[model samples]
Target: MSGSGTFAFTVHPRGRLREDLARAWRPLGLVPEAVYDAALRRLPLPPVTMATAQIGGERVGDVVLVPFGARHLLADVVGGRRRVGQAVDRAVALGADVVGLGALTATVTAGGMTLGERTDIGVTNGNAFTAAIVEDQIRLLLDRTAGGGSRPHIAIVGASGSVGSAVTRLLARDPAGARLTLIARTAPRLDALAADVADSVEVAVAHTIDAVADADLVVLLTASADTLLGPQHLAPGAVVLDATQPRNTSPDLRVQRPDVLIVDGGIVSVPSLRLRGGDIGLPDGRSYACFAETAILALTGHRGHFSLGNPTLERIDEIRARARELSHLGFRAAEPTSFGAPIALESRSAVIA
Candidate 1:
């Protein structure tokens, strides 16, 4: 990762056809599913050059958007892999020093292992900083909401996945007395993760979202394409950190449970960059943590594949350190955001009012 070189941040469609107007119009005969099928058959569509990013008043890198449609999530593993490779190929062709995989591109490729093998450029799944950011934000949220009083009970959904598991490990390593419950579809993995923790941290295992209903803070990292946590699954005044692509927390929950604070995980505020187009999906000064990881790596001149698979505790620590170094240069977490919009302080106050 050289400061003079450019990097590509690969982003995918959020695996929901309903969000795409072209695909969403199929039912009324306005458009046909065959059109979407043809698009899928095309496999990895041509890489779209998204935007050029400037960091600290200098041109640092450019962002690329890759559209690997929803079919990749619907039991098309081979197609998913091809789409990932195509995105990597485009980045490599564009002379990117490194490429950061966003959303399903990272997960479906098994933390970018297979894609990394296909390209010579550095690659990252972006989970390392995502975990670090989520952990730091959780502590900040607690301090604001709970006033640093007593230890809070925490629940991590999809605890077996890479991001979820990393979050669990980092939080467990903290000296605080917060209790944690690991929730996933499998019991064996949950049991194994719990056994890995130190004895001082109270930890348990559950296989359902219901287990989080009593938690004071919930971190949602599930890979499910649909929503899991609803109004009923949150306790009053509970804060949820949603790290998934399609988002584990539903928008309906905002109306159903206004008391619950649902913040989009891994959004950072960058002071240097000015965003132009609508491709990257962030407001004026905000960025996704995954993209920020790539920029930080490039800025710090870290050249190598990072955050692959389940990152080791040491690796997570190193990424956090680098991110902090960037923070000194004006790369820091932005104000809390939900669905790419600024979350107004009055909205939260209105809920309490």
Candidate 2:
């Protein structure tokens, strides 16, 4: 544990992504801000190092927040990369041994590979740990609902993406016998992924969301700016892991469909923290798994770009092993979170009953 060096994490104004961030602005409508964001996107802006925090205790390290917003990052890729790369350079200049890319900053840059190539410090999208935790929480949900009885039909949206592909590979390796359907916009990528996991589990491919509507368990990983899955697209008692940052399931579904279990995937427990609860969209003692991944790398001294494009099954397993080790040291996954808190299991049961 010699590598307790400072690290920086890139974040953007999540925009209308979460209800907490969109509250008062929600009444004003997303268009005005989106339009303003579009205007801001045109300006050449450098990544701002917004805040610095000292994470104390056994695994002490400093964490810096680098500014980038989903709206701006998605609107202009070339400009966004320039800004993010600038942020990384700043972190490196400021003595950060590693930097973690969050939200669109992690995804749009080829999962941190291209960005890492530009920096001497370590780079990671932090998707490996994310994929592991998502898969674990999905199994826990299934155990609670399905009770290990029958094999469930699982569908993964954005199956061709890094996190989706890793989740698909992990789930396929499970002996639970769940059938998988990979959904993505590209047919060739889906076919290739399905073929890769052909020996592990029963697999199929689809280029549309409709094919996954009937699935008992759905994992949403699409990088779409807007929500994709709605109440009409899921079956009763369906469990959804909305792994996408902006959330793949529309906010309306939380009220419209109490019968469904929608978990904000990739949340993990953090021991020491000095941030307001509402600021980060997480309750006390919890953080995003991607953030935790950076902490893990910094604490464990694993350097270089990690969990980049097309992360192999072996790499995912290796990260999962590290997570297990962290769990022993008091770092672990938090309770399944939905609508900004631990999901209401009683309500879920009432709907199921």
Candidate 3:
């Protein structure tokens, strides 16, 4: 898997919030040139670099650094389909057997469909693999914290989004008998999603934070523009999967809730990749699920969109099988980390309680 093969490319934009807001406001008449100038004066320039990895004897590459810094830029680039096409072309030129879109890239690309149409190489959004990892993490947390006694009540925030809906459906089918809560800004959409899973579990809709007040486990996959869950909102001994890229978890939680466990959803480990950097937020040797999906597909020689749409139970199983078959060459979620601190399973109970 090492000598000149398929490369996985992860595209990342670098900048702080003020810079992003200034860029957005520049196009509008909202802010004056002086304001933009002042903001830039105070902003520290951050360089965006492409994070590449070689997996399964093949080189997996990621294309980081877009011109714009906000989610809107991400959405626009992949929204029209033409830009996603261009992005895919760039990946293929870099020797990618399959390209995986991360976060907003995947969301706006329409589940890799548009990108696939534009690129000769395979394209995948990697949601199926993400679902698998999220579920695995939830189970691990429950086992460590709850002693596997009773299924923890779980809440899927942003349940109307593509990833959130899929996660809700998957959790509903689990035999753990965990109570499930579906949260979204759109009440109707939440209700519909809940109805879809009605047969599997008792599902309810939550349009506000109060709905998730009693939740023991929370999976946040929302595309919301602002942070939804904060330290005050969560109960003690809670486990949260911050699936959103910029993150939906509040910064205050780091100092506020030492008892709750927070794990980034996309982190996974892939074989044959030697990462020199000590750790980039994730535990050492682990890659994001989106990153791993591209490598996994390259390893198994799958060159198509493996996961898309509001993922269903059936689709989840299919991806799990594919991941399992390539288990020798797959990625696992990074261990739980709190406020940028690593949490060991043995010590998790004491820290949370």
lDDT, each prediction: 0.74, 0.72, 0.63
Q: Report the candidate with higher TM-score, 2 versus 3.
A: 2
Q: In candidate 2, what are the lDDT values of residues 178-245, reduced to their tens digit?
A: 88989999888889989988998999899989987789888888887777887888888888888788
Arrange candidates by lDDT, highest first: which order? 1, 2, 3
lDDT of 1 by residue, 1-353 (tens): 23446678877656444344322123423556556556756655676655677776777766666556544544676777776777788888888888898877777788888765654889998888888788877776666666455878889898888888888888878847788989999888778888988475889889988999889889888776677888978888888888777677777888898788887887877876664343455655667777888887878887878878887789888887887777656556676666555564332232221
Error of 1 at 209 (Å): 0.8
lDDT, candidate 3, 5-80, per-residue tens: 3644444332244433423233433555455445433454332333445454443555433333334444455332
List the lowest-lDDT window of 10 residues for candidate 3.
Answer: 275-284
Q: Give the Cα error of residue 12 in candidate 3, in Å.
A: 2.9
RMSD of each: 3.9, 3.8, 6.1
Residue 12 local lDDT, model 1: 61
Reference-based TM-score of each model: 0.87, 0.87, 0.79
Clashes (N, CA, C under 3 Å) per candidate? 3, 1, 25
What C-alpha lDDT does candidate 3 achieve relative to the native structure?
Answer: 0.63
lDDT of 1 at 230: 85
Candidate 1 TM-score, C-alpha based: 0.87
Model 2 misplaced regions, further than 4 Å = 1-3, 17-35, 58-68, 276-278, 344-353
Number of the top candidate by lDDT? Answer: 1
